[model samples]
Target: MRNSRNSKSNKSKSTVMFILVLLIVGALAYTGAFGINNIFGYRVKSFEQAINKGLDLQGGISVLEELQAENIDNETIERTKELLSMRINPEGVKEISITREGSNRIRIEIPGEFDAKKVLETIGKTGKLEFKGPDGKVILTGKDIKNAKAYLDEMSKPTISLDLNQEGTGKFAEGTQKFLGKEIGIYMDGDLLTNPTVQSVITNGKATITGSSSLEEANRKANIIKSGALPVTLEAVEFKTVGATLGANALPLSMKAGAMGIGLVLLFMLIYYRGPGIMASIALVFYVVIVLLAFSVTGVTLTLSGIAGFLLTVGMAVDANVLIFERIKEEMKIGKTIKNATETGFNRALSSILDSNITTIIAGIVLYSLGSGSVKGFALTLMIGIVLSIFTALTVTKFLLKLGTEMGLLSDASHFGVKRG
Candidate 1:
């Protein structure tokens, strides 16, 4: 009778295991990692691939720029970040990070090699794009134009065409008519962008500024126009230029440390929990996969500090499994059946797991609020790791544990590391 009951239980667990494997396989296929794209086609780059590779790893010049602002409040700080992001992007920079530090100070980091003068012009220039009529009268200002793109003219000279909103369109139509045959002046922060003779009256609010001899100059003008027209103005406060080799040294050291830590963890788990520790180690790999997926999907930036936080969470992940296994051993020592002890052990450990993770998450939120720069990076990663750990531990680990028991792998307390007297 007992053998028949065990057979039915084994069949039920096998079905569940099949379903779980199918789900994981399907997910991998959908992501194109193990399907048609992997076998026959080139895979498209995910956003993570486009993510600004930090200067530390890929090699780049890191630039910190300080900006002057009337008010150093949160809104100003955010707008400053946006402006710097826009400013640095044109220099063919690999990665750019802008942050507010003290009450009135801002720090900017630009990765990749850059020319000093070009970098300065990109950030220091106050964009004030404008359109003038043939009569040398102002028709539209940078605020009136929405966006600018660079194109080549008949002689291959670079030109910038502007797109304007409705309000600018109406005003521009009236101005064009009045200034027919006059030169229209384009300016940036009172400096000349271009002064081209107006050839026609444009009523559509779209106009072109031409006569640049080089494409680089034309593109630079377009960027300046885009920056100046922003509703808020930017002042560069601090600038840092880091050589590209910094990451070359740090990355290997970090990888070595992580490997050592994981190795130590595996050794300790095997020594303390025996057979069940091996199972927990297998589950930890799944935990890592789930966490990596979360980071990629959430657009989390993996900084140096972020990696440390992740390693700490990995330790905490093992701690949860250790706690549960310890409790199951206690239950086994009291003479409970393996199945009852497994279930009861997990239940008894649930409150402790929840309480500890919740406290850590709360602490992470506080650190994020109080700290800036790398500290915030650490806090953000810690928060994400803690949340993902809960899901992996509670769902994935629990399912695997139950499956092991039903498969006869963990059929006896002794197999699960309970000492038999």
Candidate 2:
């Protein structure tokens, strides 16, 4: 009966272990860590692809637009900020930063190749909403426009159609009727953006702006229309555009340096920990994958400083594994079974792991709040790395260790660097 009970327990343990491994592996596979591409058709984005590279590594433009102080209320200020973001990111800019500098100013930084003049034109222009008659008659102003959206025509051309309120609709219908066969000029901040001729009476309170345009231009105009009009005008105070050549030079150098650091760290781990070091190395690979996935999912920007943070967290992760291994070795020296030593070592190390991670997280939070630009990037990545490291250390490493013990792979104390009792 006792032999049968032991057999049942071993079977249950095996089943549980198999299920856990499958879950972890399945999750990883679903996340595109194993496949050539993610479940989606697109190639799985790598660490470089997922985390947005910053200005130092990617070489791009950083335009700073400062807002002048006005008697703007909070609601209007928020609305204006939204409008500016829409204009700068019409086709969805990457790693572009738009931050309120002070109570009276805003700072815009776009980290990619972009036309300085074009970006300036976008940032400096006060998105003026306009309404004109079919015959180019001045009918109503942007204040009359309640909402706007973009759609595609039968020919697949992007069309920006807008709706006016009941009062504006009535006025717009009247204007359309009076100015048939004429063009309506839509001016933004006194600059003509679209001029379309009115064909029929638009009594539905809706009008479509049609013109020849590129995909990006259509999207920009649509975004500008959607954001409504800014309460206050803005001017570009500072703009800097970095050449692509400059970014090309920096990217390779940065990658080379980062690779060297990682290689050295891996080398040191192998030398110090031996067999257990290989386990930590495997966990580290998973660590990198988890970190990259987190960044990709969260859209975290990767600057040179962020990479530095990641490297530091790598060391921290290894440190946690080292602590657990050393404790297990000590327990083994006292004649504890391999399973008992492993279990106790993990339990004993839990508090220390939590304490170390909590302290690092607190510092990361403080740095994130106080830092700006690359510093903020570093803090954000560091915080993510620390949290992920804890998961890998506590969960992934523990599971592997348990599996090793069950497989009789680490039956002797010498496997973990301890003398037998």
Candidate 3:
């Protein structure tokens, strides 16, 4: 009578747990990752809305600019690239990419920003660097400076250390002595950047530009100075905008296909593995929610290729469950109890699952490091998915399986797809 009572208690507890799991998973799927709208007059934003989308997905502008200068040097090109990058992506909130193409050409991609003309106006000008005395006489040009970098001085204050060339060393020394107690204006493209009162006269060719609010501001100021030294005119060789409508069409199709694929996988697992399949399906839903949350939190810009990468990970997730279930069946075939078989199966399959996931992760890392644009998006999502899949398979799936076992729901060999002798 007591054993029957315990069985009844277990069944009641299991039913409650099942309902809770279902409701939680359903809520996450409906409102968290996929999102919902206007139930109580508040919009539940989708992950795509929160995270940035790549140029291919959101549609923006692409520009190919080439440096127009005689005897172009690598230093100039690199500095110019840094300047444009900082100028265009000042906030670092936008998915703006500036990459070097060949030796003199730069490819710029701005996602979700349509106007190419405005962007060109921002980056086209050769903001000539100039240092002017109190008498308004030109003292130094950008070419006179050897290097400029921001650093924290002994007092922990952000300072821009400027190194001048041999010719600039002598010129700056005379100017500093002449304007020792006076304000000397630092100008970029005719706009006064700063007018620092010369503190002392030094002939060492090194000077510090101070009075920046933050280290980031100091860095930007240094880049501005280096950029004004741009000896080449940035001519827009090519400029074009991507189509927002085209991306809009493709995104929905990709999402539908992914949903269909996941649905089919869930159905297959249910029909084949029975009890373990039910647990796997729940685990998979949780995996999807976790992955989407990761993307949203990390601000990983998603592209079409990135979506493909995620869909591929869904397959690997199911593969992991399949490995564990097969191992469980093997253990049960030799007369091991369901509980013992589950623990042994997870332990035995751990190595194989890790090996496969690790290898794929390595590949993703390589692609991310070496590839550009869409390739990079694909690699990033693929890596994140694989990592989360391992978590879901080992941690989430195992926990759910153990819970089901404790509830007496996964007690038989037949439940795990094994025929008893």
Candidate 4:
């Protein structure tokens, strides 16, 4: 009687935990970090909106710009590429590609950017930021700027605060002392941004630029200033806007292929391993949900190559389940009961699964750190998939198999693909 009561209590707890897991997965699948408005007037955030598509999925603008300075070196080009990437993408834009073309040129491709002219103006501008005294003598340049940020002032107005390096601070102090009570002009590419009166000689390295029309404008200025000025001026030698029709069509085909592949995997798992395969299939659903949610939350831009990587990991996920199930069958054939066989199988398979996945993950990390563009997309997706695959195989599959045995559904050796000895 006591054993019966304990068994019932454990089954009830398992049921509750399984239901909780289902609810969490469902919630993650439908809603992400933000809310989305549907046609029926309901607002809910979805993984579809959270996952950003790359250039191959939604085409946009591409620009080829060349440095205007003579004797431009590879070092200067590399630095410019890094700066442009920081300025254009920052933390908001996704899947923006900036690469070097030749000895003196850069190729920039930004997907889903609507304003080509605005992008051109922002990226191609010389961005020679300067602070000048009333007599038009340059006091400091952007190179001297240590940092720049946008913030709200005491009156709730938008403002840009500048932090200058030691050299800039000294130069600014000297200039302010020489021109007290006069205006200091702030310029970018010869265009005056603001001219503030030097009320007092400032010794501190901090200064603020107020009078921005709005917070957006202030932020824009701050971002440009913080990204630093290019060593050589850039001229747009070629510019074009790419259409998305091809990418749009390609996406459906790619998704169809992926769906078909995953469907086949599920069917094979269900048929080959029987009851355990069914459990593995269920765990796979959780794996997919978790991986997609991870991609959405991490802001990983999904490209064609990334999708391929994801599909590859899906196959590996099935392979892991197969290894464990075969090991279970072997243990069961050796006269172990279903519960003991399950535990021993997982233990025997653990080392191989971890070794394979960990090595793949290391390769993915290396690729992500060293490669750029689509290579990075592929590496990121591969890493995410491998991690989720391992979790599902070890945790979810193991729990479900145990649950099956506890419920008396998988007591017989034949239920786990083993013949009675």
Candidate 5:
């Protein structure tokens, strides 16, 4: 009778501890997602707002352009993209992406861009290449060149290798002789690519340009010189104009559906597995926080597809808990103590969880390697989710279960989904 009274006292204390855990975790999760106003003199912004959003989640313009040439090949398409990249990314990197969709189509996506007319004008500009001498006279044009390549020097520094045709060779030889020791500028569409002083006269039609800071810079300059004019014209076949309001509408709907599903899962866990269910729910809260923190730290661009991957992982996490809970019930029915059953259950469930998650992670890798655009985004989120799911299932869930056992909250068989005789 004295032992029974002590058992009841311990269970009551555990109940109070569980309630406190719930309140604290819930408050923290809410603050992390939505944030609050200023407490003293400092203002706080939400982590969610700081995270980058995709064109579907934010606002953007997508253009599908087709090469209007009879004999266009993959090499030509790549060169075309290089040309467009030069025009769009002249200053530096922006929220822009240029990718190949099929054999003849190239897709360009620019996020937070709504001015369709201005964007179209920029895309339409296909400028000529010119090599102007010291006196601003045209020394050589792009039509005279055979090919340009970027390579490394003997000292492992970056340089550009120029190859000229017969006509360009003669003209370049004469020009170099006249302009020796003078600076001549290589210009593409009125923008200066490089200005190097003439070192000597070259009759062999090959020259090298040094002073490139890096291989990447040399490659950019070489690509411009090699493909100053595209092999075919890019006709904008499809223009998709997405507004910020549309994305705003999409986010709320997606959130509503996701919330409803998560709420139902939490409710089911609470109803079925009494105490272990509560512990798993708390671990899940931390799982969510960790996943979002990972995304924020990595600067992952979130999209609707990425959100789908995230939600799918949430379900997988719940499935793991369900498996462990079932195993605990089986162990308890065989006359084991609650703590012993918990340890055995987690061990038994671990192999199955690892097998399932590892297979999914491999699939995510395949998708990420071969896929493009939104598909790649989804794959990244899926891989991240699978890894995090395994971590929380093994570590966080087990820790919480162990905590409950020590607190004497899981002494009853029914608390782990087992029915006592």
Candidate 6:
């Protein structure tokens, strides 16, 4: 009777494990198959929409601009970079890279933007902002403005609100008082932004500019106004636009290489370790699904180098399973039952796995912190892959192996690549 009860309990556990694995596979499939528009009534970006491609993968414009100022220090150059990035990518454009190339040059790469001249016009200008009276005399400069924001008025029309400094308040109040019933023109880089007729004296240092065509335009103007003018003038020194054809060609080749690598790894694992290898490969599929989901959710830009890093981490995942399986085989050869060998193997391999993964994680962090462009992208994917690899190896692979043993499918030493002594 006791033996029969034990058999029932083992069967129950195996059933639970099977259901759990099925749920995981179903979730992965649903995520990969569906688009962003429909996902159980909650809108979310799909896998393709979420994983951003870098400039090397998607052709775009690259602009190299030099600061047209003498004796430009690093502080000034950094400030220029910050302001320019704000202008070019105000809404956090994906895969946009801006870096200081030299003491006086800044390089900007915007992927998926085809218009080089328009980008140059937007970022190359000095963006000096001025407020002028009806007589065309300058009343206040961007330096005198304290803050700017985009918002909707009571009428639901987009507007840019401005807050002035104390000195600017005094000047604007006097100018408005004198120019009542006349216009006050706001200009940036010699181009008029808005010319609103003065209605009253604004002694409180607050004013609003209306007549923006859209919310996007109003927000863009507000952002530029808030960032103030570039401390130094920028001149486009070099400009290049990569063709989409080149990027299109490169991606398929990269995908084919990655696919071939993963196929070989799967084949080798299945041939060497038999049943346990099959289980490891299944866990590997889970690892990949989790990693890709993470990338899509986190909006990590995938580049060629990032793909290579991800593939390397796939090998690491295989290595972890190999370590545990080898230890399990050792225990089995010493006359231990399948259950005992599996548990002991996991315990023995835990320390080595933790040490290796932790060290690699540290290295990835360092690279992400210090590296630029594709290097940072690679490091990010590597770090993410390392974390997910550890999870699948410890939880998914172990559970699958235990299920196999409990069901009597993986009990022999030969199934785990060892001969019984």
Best-matching candidate per lDDT: 3
Clashing pairs in 2: 134-182, 135-182, 136-183
Candidates by TM-score, descending order: 4, 6, 3, 2, 5, 1
* lDDT values, one for every candidate: 0.71, 0.75, 0.87, 0.83, 0.84, 0.85
Tell me the spans in candidate 1 whose CA falls farther than 4 Å from its real position.
Answer: 1-38, 43-53, 69-73, 90-94, 134-137, 143-170, 176-226, 229-238
Tell me the deviation in Å of residue 141 in model 6: 2.4
Candidate 2 lDDT by residue in tens digits, 1-421: 9988885687568657746765775566445434446445666655565667777777778766655666656676677777878877766765687666556566777777577788787776756666665445568777777777776789988778787888889888988888788877777666677777888989989888778476567767767666656777776777777777766887678768866876776777667766566567667767877887888789887777888898888888888988898888888888999889989999999899889989999999998887667778899989999999999998988877776665555657777777664
TM-score of 1: 0.73
* Model 6 Cα shift for residue 49 (angstroms): 4.5
- Kindly list the per-residue Cα lDDT of model 6 for residues 52-73, writing each as its tens digit: 8878888898888898989999
Model 5 per-residue lDDT tens digits across residues 1-421: 9998897787777667767777877876886788777858765556567567889978899999988877677787887887787666653346577888877888998888889998898788766788889889997888888888888999999999999999999989999999999888999879898998899998999999989999889977887787666667889999998889878988889878988998888888889888988888888887887787788778888889999998999999999998888898899999998888888999999999999889999999998887888988899998898899899988888877876876766768877767777
Clashes of each: 26, 3, 0, 1, 0, 0
Candidate 4: residue 38 Cα off by (Å): 7.2
User: What is the Cα-based lDDT of residue 324 in candidate 2?
Assistant: 90
lDDT of 3 at 258: 94
List the pairs of residues colliding in candidate 3. Answer: none
Alpha-carbon RMSD of each model = 7.1, 5.7, 4.2, 3.9, 6.2, 3.9
- Winner by TM-score: 4
Candidate 4 per-residue lDDT, tens place, 38-88, comes to 848876656556688888788888888988998887878887887788667
- Cα displacement (Å) at residue 63, model 6: 1.7
Model 3 stretches with alpha carbons more than 4 Å out? 1-31, 34-45, 66-80, 101-105, 144-173, 200-222, 231-237
Error of 5 at 370 (Å): 5.4
**Residues 1-421, candidate 1, lDDT per residue (tens digit)?**
9999889978787657846854774564345322233545565443235333455555554445444446556776676566566667754333466666767666665556557678777766655566655455667776787778788888777889888889988987787677677776777666776777767888887888887778877887777676654444445544555565666677668768986898788888878877677667667766765665667666666667887998989988988888888888999999999889888998998999999999999999999988876787789889888887887777777776677777666778778767788
With candidate 1 superimposed using the best TM-score fit, by how many Å does residue 320's alpha carbon deviate from the native? 1.4
The parts of candidate 2 lying over 4 Å away from their true place are 1-45, 70-77, 145-222
Model 5, runs deviating above 4 Å: 1-31, 35-45, 70-76, 90-93, 127-129, 138-181, 193-231, 362-373
lDDT of 6 at 253: 94
Error of 5 at 187 (Å): 2.7
State how far residue 21 of model 1 sits from its true place (Å): 5.3
